[model samples]
Target: MRETGLLSLEAKKRHARTKIHGYYEGAFKFTRPVRLDDDCLSVYLIHVGGGYVDGDTYGSTITLGEGAELAVTSQASTKVYKTPSKPVEQHTKIHLGADSVLEYFLDPLILYEGARFIQNTTIEMEPDAVFFYSDIITPGWSKDGVNFRYDWVRNKLKVYQNGKLVLFDHLLLEPDDELEGVLQLEGHTHVGSFVLFHPEASREFAEWLYENVFESFPDVRLGISDMEGGGIVIRILGDRTQTIERILSHIHTFARRELLDKGEISWRKY
Candidate 1:
């Protein structure tokens, strides 16, 4: 059976406080918006089955009104169970109004042996809006203790601002007979990426992030580059999931404090 989920969010300012309005969800569930601060709203996405199965399909849409601030995340890692016949699919779309802020950060995706999964995410924002997004992929345990057991994984991400395409990222990994010679994983079991798009983004921010990472995490390999529309693009590869997760958390925390001038966000689920 195919399962579908939908969500929408809007924010309005009332008496000097940002209040969330026009919120909706179906199939996929979320807890009531937790006010991290007077300006920030946090919501966590929940999966009904606890994991994705064969023939499962899910979609979510989010919109932020002008000057609204919202962050969307998942309660736990997305688990992709074995699916020998069919692949599970997920799609997400997000829209941001002028001066709005959005942060879409989620836990890693764990793929079991013989699992197949596809995901697509698109974001459209006004020229002055601020956005941050990230995700990770890690190989799950297998009985044979062999690496790269997943059949295939594909992910695509696109971002647009002021009706102009600003960034496009695509990733595909399929282990087969020639997997040994390929550099897909580069002898690593986990891979991750993060992106930040805002008017304040500059080369100095990217440089600072790149330099700071080397001092703390020497084992993880990281690459940082500038996006077309004044933001930072980061690619990370590591052997341990915890190492990558920690690195991402550090970056996200820094961005929130420096860019938004907000304090650390605490989630009860974690």
Candidate 2:
């Protein structure tokens, strides 16, 4: 069966600040949002079921009205079990209006033996729209405790601004293939990526970000690249999931303090 979720928020200026004028939710569920000092709202995404099974299909659409700013994150990591017949499928589409902001940060994904999963994401933004996204992938357990035993994993991303495509990214990992090659995981068991799209993004900022965020993690092989218009993309490869997460934490701090200018943030999950 196909299950779909929807989320929409409109921004309204009041009390000398921006607030959500209206919002909508569908099949997807989220915890109550909390307002931050910068007028940005934070919300946590919830998966009704604990994990994904065979033939499971999930889709979500998100839209932010003009001037709106929102931050979203997953409550926990996503787990994908064996999919003998069909792979678990997920698709997400996001729309941002002028001067909008969105930060999508999700936990690691756990793929068990024989697991197969596919995910696709597309983003459409108008001018002056800022966006940040990051995710990690981890190998799940197997009978023999070996890593990379899954069937395969595929993730694709596309971003467009003013009806012009600015970025396109695709990733695929198969355990049966050689993962220790120079162009592959390079003996790493975990992988992650961070994407930042903002008008102020520049090579200098990317270098600064590398120095501030990636230099601290010696165990991880990191790379940063520039986008066509103005943005940066970060690639992270690490041996342990914890290390990757630690890098992500630093990246988050950098983003909030430097990019979003909201200072340190806490989900209050504790």
Candidate 3:
């Protein structure tokens, strides 16, 4: 079955809150907005079925009105179970108004053996809006105890500002034949990525991220670069999931405090 969800938030001066005006569908449910001391709304996306199954399709759309601030995260990592017949697919779309802020720092996606999945995310924002996004991919538990056993996995991310495309990132991993090849995992089992698109993301910030954040983690192979439209992109490869998660979390926390002027607020799902 196909499951769909939609959410729209607008800033209301009457109560100084970003209220959710539109919501639809099930399985892809969201909790009530939690007001943070930083005046930003935090919403958690919950998968009612717990994980993805064969032939399952899910879609979600989120929009932020002008001057609105919102932080979105998932209740837990997206688990992709074994699918023999068909692959599960998920699509997400985001829109940001002028001067709005959006933080989408979600958990990783774990793929079990025989699991096949595809994910596509598109973002359109105004010139002055701020956007932060991060994602990770890790191998799930297998009976054979071998890593990178998944059949196929694909992820695509596209970003646009003021109707001009600025970033397009794509990744495809099929570890059936050559798992240790240089073009594949390159002997790494886990991969993670982080992106920040804001007006203040200068080359200096990129250098600072490489020196301060990436340098702190000596085990992981990290790469940092500047995007076309004043954005920062980071890629990481590691053997342990916890190590990669910690590095990305630190970057997110630092960005929140420096760019959004907000203290780190933990999202407790358990």
Candidate topping lDDT: 3
Ordered list by lDDT, greatest first:
3, 1, 2
Clashing pairs for predicted structure model 3, backbone only = none
TM-score head-to-head 2 vs 3, winner: 3
> Pairing residues by index, what is the TM-score of model 1?
0.92
Task: Give one digit per residue, the lDDT tens place, for model 3 in 107-206.
Answer: 8999998899999999999988999999999999988899977898999999999888898899898886577668677888889999999888889878
Candidates in order: C-alpha RMSD to true structure: 2.1, 2.3, 2.0
Q: How accurate locally is residue 254 in candidate 1, as Cα lDDT from 0 to 100? A: 83
Which candidate leads in TM-score?
3
In order of TM-score, best first, we have: 3, 1, 2
Cα lDDT of candidate 3 equals 0.83
> Which should have the higher TM-score, number 1 or number 2?
1
Candidate 2 Cα lDDT to native: 0.81
Please estimate how well model 1 matches the true structure, expressed as its whole-model Cα lDDT.
0.81
Worst 10 residues of 1 by lDDT: 18-27
Q: After superposition, how far is residue 21 of candidate 2 from its true place, in Å?
A: 8.3
Candidate 1 deviant stretches above 4 angstroms: 1-3, 21-26, 177-183
Query: How high is each candidate's TM-score?
Result: 0.92, 0.91, 0.93
Error of 3 at 104 (Å): 0.5
